[model samples]
Target: MTDPTLGELTVGVEGLALLRLLHADDRGAAQVARAARMAETREVLERLGREPSLRGPLGVELGLREGYARWAATYDGPLRLFSIEEPPVRRRLEAWPVGEVLDAACGTGRHAVRLAGRGHTVIGVDQSAEMLERARAKVPGGRFVEGGLTDLPLPDAAVDAALCALALVHLPDVAPAVAELARVVRPGGRILISDVHPFLVQLGWQAQFPVGDGRAFVRLHRHRVTDYAAAALAAGLVVSGVEEPALTPEAARTPTTELVPEATETAYAGLPGVVIWEFARP
Candidate 1:
């Protein structure tokens, strides 16, 4: 399939913005906003006519290995998801007794370093060797292994606790990975998981990152609340707690927001950015 053009993206944004404004109780104000959105759409069409090159591809889609390798260099930069996901995950991780903790899909050792610092023996596993290299370098004392989340490198009941953060969304089916986590943790040991909420995925969010002048994205899958609950139960894990932290306006903003700030912000406002799940083996 051909990558969507910039003009196509702009038109879609304008349509969404107008749809968001059409429901205002103040009909007069809504009419004015709709007119502005229409004008913006018209301007994009005119520009595309004048410069046909404006219809060039906006981004390229990449596989997980290639995407993470390209992203590893700038992975430590200010990512909004990390900011929102870290606080809650950290709170729960800190609450656990400091024992061996498995950081599955532990890109760049973001959580492994902290677990190591807190005196827990950290075992970090990830599919991307480039990311694992960064993780190894960042947390020299922690054990970093190159491995997939569905087939962990450790034995059954190997760790006291496990954390799989912001990674489950990448999997098309989360059941195998969930079962793997359940298998690795000892009985009564806890597991913590954080992922992009399925709501956002339904709203067309993908794992996007910058690549030179254009953008690149890795497609994400939607794993609903029930999907997770069913998988955990089937794996003999009980849900201890769940948290759906709403996105801050800043964290919710997307590149398209620049064109329709109010409409875009309104669509995402008060929406949960990530879902955190805490499970325990009985």
Candidate 2:
């Protein structure tokens, strides 16, 4: 028999609620939280020894456009991932030349606003119109466009620096996007790409957020560090630096209403949580 509210409790905050219930008694909730974290409601139910009433894929691969449209509203609202990302990204950008900058996949202009404020002429691009709209408002003087990393609507060698934070893993193959980034950035210019380290993915963790009743998981492709290096080298970009920042006790202590509490807080205690790469267009 199905848990009557299983559908509502399988994704996002709702899903966490279910786990919190189980976590009260079953230490295994942590395991299930990661194993079934962002999968389909029915599938998770089946794993939990129950029959589901609704039958379907756990979550559709929404691609970038539809996915961002759904995610834009809450992109930076309920969750607080910047705590893990901002410090390293800001550090990398600090050494970059203050010139024309491109924030590829500039979701909600989080980076754009920061770059523009620091005297860099920034153009933000993303595939989601909704996100671009938010980006436009967040950085009123900054230019925001709707496009993608693999096919940016920009001329070759157009910018002095480009920052694509946490966007590459969404692609099945990374070569074309790296090639595209290489093409757009002038020689000696820089490109910084960040992603959730592949180790967590291998352990069944995923990037997920709540939709209506359930959480929607971002369809992610695990890219080993070697894969990124290979793509960057083939694209004529020099790999200047690679930083794999592990989860910190400080960040974990930071409070948040994050959905789906996986055992990773403990399992990933001292493991890499993010991979930030710095590349030179030369």
Candidate 3:
């Protein structure tokens, strides 16, 4: 079969028109249009917009108005502080005798670049073409593919190790992604996944604050630690270890503290912003 056309693969002109109408800004519209050309972006936005829970006033306020855009901007600053730095996850993978590594949902190729730098053949996959473009620029030697965590295009047992960092929370279902991760890695190979702690989701801290009212303060997605484990088991993987990385007090300081005082340095340092799990495909 021929590959889908760019318009067919993406949101198409119709969705782009809606985005333009909602945003009411040419710049945002242009950006959305550009992103919609990629299959992943089209899928994500369509899924997000089509959810029943995401309709009505709350949906308009949270999703269409400025929710995703706000979160997207935070990736450069406040969110960056909470991201997984090179050393911790990198050390664990480098210690293993793996050759080919797959960085699923490899945002900006941070970990993928590090893995490649350590002489591992790494392939980075993400749904966002915009993100993959950035990843390609950052990690020139590594291969970057456009795909979702649930529907990977690679063959079965294709890699020695697979890593996913801070990407699963956005997915509506974790089981499919977990199964895909297992399917792509060889038996006894490792699958490392790190995501925002479920506790943070339960606490309703995933949503941005300082909205007109607190209506958007509630949790927007379902995230449970047990579900993650179950997904792994169903995918025929054994959980080897689970770890929570603590953030330094200094690293937690940010301007958003004014809006989320409860998320102060002292409070977050004791909580798990990042949770890492090791799964062995068996």
- lDDT of all predictions: 0.86, 0.73, 0.65
The reply for model 2, stretches above 4 Å from the true place, is 1-61, 78-80, 249-264
Candidate 2's C-alpha lDDT? 0.73
Error of 2 at 238 (Å): 1.2
Q: What is the per-residue lDDT of model 2 for residues 1-282, given as tens digits with 9 covering 90 to 100?
A: 432232333333334434444554556765565455445344554555544433333444456677778989998873434567788899889887689998998989888888998999999988889988988988888888888889999999999989898788788888898889899999889999888777755644455666887657677787777888999999988988988887665443221223223422433445677888999987
Question: What is the C-alpha lDDT profile of model 3 across 12-44, one tens digit per residue?
Answer: 333433443454357765566445434444453
Give per-model TM-scores. Answer: 0.89, 0.75, 0.66
Best by TM-score: 1
Best of the two (2, 3) by TM-score: 2
TM-score of model 1 vs. true structure: 0.89
Model 1 scores what on Cα lDDT?
0.86
Q: C-alpha displacement of 185 in model 3, angstroms?
A: 0.5
**What's the best-to-worst order under lDDT?**
1, 2, 3
- What C-alpha root-mean-square deviation, in Å, does candidate 2 show against the real structure? 7.4
lDDT, candidate 3, at 137: 88
